[model samples]
Target: MVTVTAAVTEASSELIARARAGDDEAFQALTEPYRRELHVYCYRMLGSVQDAEDALQETMLAAWQGLAAFEQRASLRTWLYRIATNRCLNTRRTAARRPATQWSVPGVEPPEPTRLGEVAWLEPYPDSLLDEAADAPPGPEARYEQSESVSLAFVTALQLLPPRQVAVLVLRDVLGFPAREVAAMLDATVESVNSALKRARAALRRRPPRAQHEPAPPAGSAAEDAIVAKFVNAYESADLDALVALLTDDVFISMPPMPFEYEGLSAARDFCALFLGTGREYVLVPTRANGQPAFGLYLRADGVCRATSLLAITLAGNRVCALSRFDGSVLPRFGLPQSLPDGP
Candidate 1:
């Protein structure tokens, strides 16, 4: 890793020099490597993939315009973050806070939610994007693993923090930057940075656990395959008992853009009873989301299969624990078709 880092730095130094000398291609080269991680970081701060990409584009443009003034006091990564953080902060200041996801299904009434979830505007991050970003080693000061930080629950908890605190916590804890460096990026003193992180940590602690301790097996591991197969079998068969049997006792369910939250096996059963009880069969197209097992669910009705739902499942001790259900609005991001043939 050290050797690779040195080579990258060497390459970036050359590009930086050429870019400062007015080479557009060199400037692009200098900024490209940082884009994805920056995007993930922005996503973490803003809780929206689209928002993150927009901020990243703006950050690149800002970096380009400011390249001439680059003192190189901080690594390019840190400098880019400074710009992106400010951009997100500005965005949050003007944009209305995201509302909880609403239940939009017609005719099928879900059981009354036992409690309202705080992060209704939460969205799932694609595991494919994490392919490169999460695998990169967390910086020395980073307390949380990169992949772990992007968990829906963690990102949701992050959205609840003040934007500045969000930046501070991500920089200090997720990226592993020291307080002094985060202080520099945020244009604040170390003390202020530390203070913000402290508050953020306390607030995060008050939220429900976003994940269990069991290590998520590799994306296509046998264990993951088994659990996913079980889900598909139970769901497609519309066997409520078999379906409920697959869930852990404390299983959690949330549909983003809606505030409703259901927990435990009984609530899971209620959800299954409504979504699967339709006499028509459902089809499960295997997929991935937020580094967890996910599926694109479709229902066979009216001679065609149409999008019914998307589920991102969290695991604990080999049993499904947290099941995050998303409305069809998310299907496009996963490259899932809106409809499919009822036949295999």
Candidate 2:
């Protein structure tokens, strides 16, 4: 529950001193509280789970090695962010040059998308990790809730901004850092930070609306439970009508790394044609992702259900507006088994 601005407790003051003096255990204790949030920040910047982990490790090592040069002036939290955010920026610059492929299933024919999504490289942030960091309630100045900041739409919009603008916006608005302090973090003038913030805010306004402002319906609400029931029935029964009933008119479906997107019911129906044509009964293992309801889909063949994709859905009035199907490689990241026992 530690936030960036919590008054440094007396005990931590001691740890900080020892950590500065090259005490490894003291440094570990000193930085441990901020790990999860930093991990999320890096993920926001880099759009990859594995890269975020690597960034976190590099940030910590840099923080520890550079601790001796620390000026006690800045909050330890802000200093850690200085290292973490820059680490993310550096990693992203390299990744942007050499992007990886978006994974698709072997047997399932991915429908041709109407158009490509802007943040086609985007990935979901696991809520389980967010639970681990459960940040102390941010102060009023913080514009977005911790959970909202990681919403699939919000994060995807972020991937579209310039790196410096992303840094400014996340720091100044999302994290509620003051302009002066954020400028210090970005090594820019206050005026420059303010200007970037203005542009970033406008750019985001033009992107998708922040639809998921609420924490996803608490883990087993009757409403969510019913929705899950309908989804399972549709997939297992291969009832196209049942499936179509659950989607919104402007439904959006995207698979990252693949970049193809299906929009509107007509296109979506074309996309789901694969599900119907595959002739494989789907088994959906209920799960969660990015503070939204999700399912790990397994395709059944020869009495075995193998993992195919991890699908996260965004709901509107009981209909789905967005359906993000990630490569099954992300299954383990959400703590879901890659494969399930067949015949439920």
Candidate 3:
């Protein structure tokens, strides 16, 4: 039998050639490398993980069907991106805005320290993938840097803009696409593109100043470990008082898909006491999201176990200013098991 390595190499080479020659399967192979990243891009655009997945699938199908019309004028990667962006834009036109969940699923709720409208649409992407993307291959000049683009704050801020603005900001600022190329992708004039970018920047600038971010926690950092432990314990125990202590005086919290957010320690504390950790019991299964610390917050409903939601936290100077809970369905994406050990 041929070795697996040899098979993969041979298959990749054959696919690339065949795809160039109009073979759909070959095109699929050539585009597979971009699928995950494109999905992430779409997700960031839509602010709904479900919408991103749908857009990605549609983009792939469109690329496959449109291969015959593709010219070599642009790199295959760029061509794929153009298809994905158009797909997301089209989806955005018809997609309904899902109200943010106050508490995930029946009875399993985490502390809701904020209202949905105060912050931008907040969702979680697998931390593992974000980390992987941080080290992924970059082109000759590394036009776009993934290091901070995938952060919770960054992604949250992105959703506050209109879809076109989202696309323009991400392409020009995050992905570093040239204005000319961005115009072509959006089918707008360069002047129009420039105006959109200006507006996007202005909108972002008008928002309150965000706290500084530390890239990734050091492996053996006692500070982070302790904070995480205390956070998890306070949350799992439903101890509102202890939980409040971990927060900074001006900490903020927001949940997207819902229009609730909270600012300041007092507001956050009220939310935890009134909505979450009041009648709910939680078990935090450690996980990662948006290249930062995170967890799968499972809840005990009556006497049965069920998944609640995924929590992604952003830390600043040893305190958490932002804590977001993405929908529970996102668990699988981060490779987290659906169930966890029952509490003692």
Tell me, by TM-score, which candidate is best. Answer: 1
Ranking by TM-score: 1, 2, 3
Question: Which window of ten consecutive residues has the lowest lDDT sum in model 2?
Answer: 209-218
lDDT of 1 by residue, 1-344 (tens): 99999998888888999998889999987777878888888889888887888888999988999998888888887788889889888877788776765578777887989798877686777777877563346678788875578888788788788888998988888888878888888889999998999999898888766445567666678888887788789988988898788888888888887788899888878887987786768888887888788888888888899997788888665678888888777888888999998774
Residue pairs in collision within model 1? 100-257, 100-258, 101-257, 101-258, 102-257, 102-258, 141-176, 142-176
TM-score of candidate 3 to 2 decimals: 0.81
lDDT of each: 0.82, 0.80, 0.73
lDDT of 2 by residue, 1-344 (tens): 37643555667788989988878999989888899988887887777778889999999999988988877689888899999888887876766533546545666666666887666576777878878873545545679876568878788888889988888888867778888888888788999989998999999888755344333455567877887788788878988888988887788888887878888899988888777666778888887788788888888777788888888998665667888888888889888886777753
- By lDDT, the candidates rank as 1, 2, 3
Which candidate leads in lDDT? 1
Better structure of 1 and 2 per TM-score: 1
Candidate 3 Cα errors over 4 Å, as ranges: 1-17, 20-24, 99-122, 131-147, 210-222, 274-280, 300-305, 341-344
Ten-residue stretch with the least lDDT total in model 3: 134-143
| Candidate 3 whole-model C-alpha lDDT, 0 to 1 | 0.73
Clashes of 1: 8
Clashing pairs in 2: 102-257
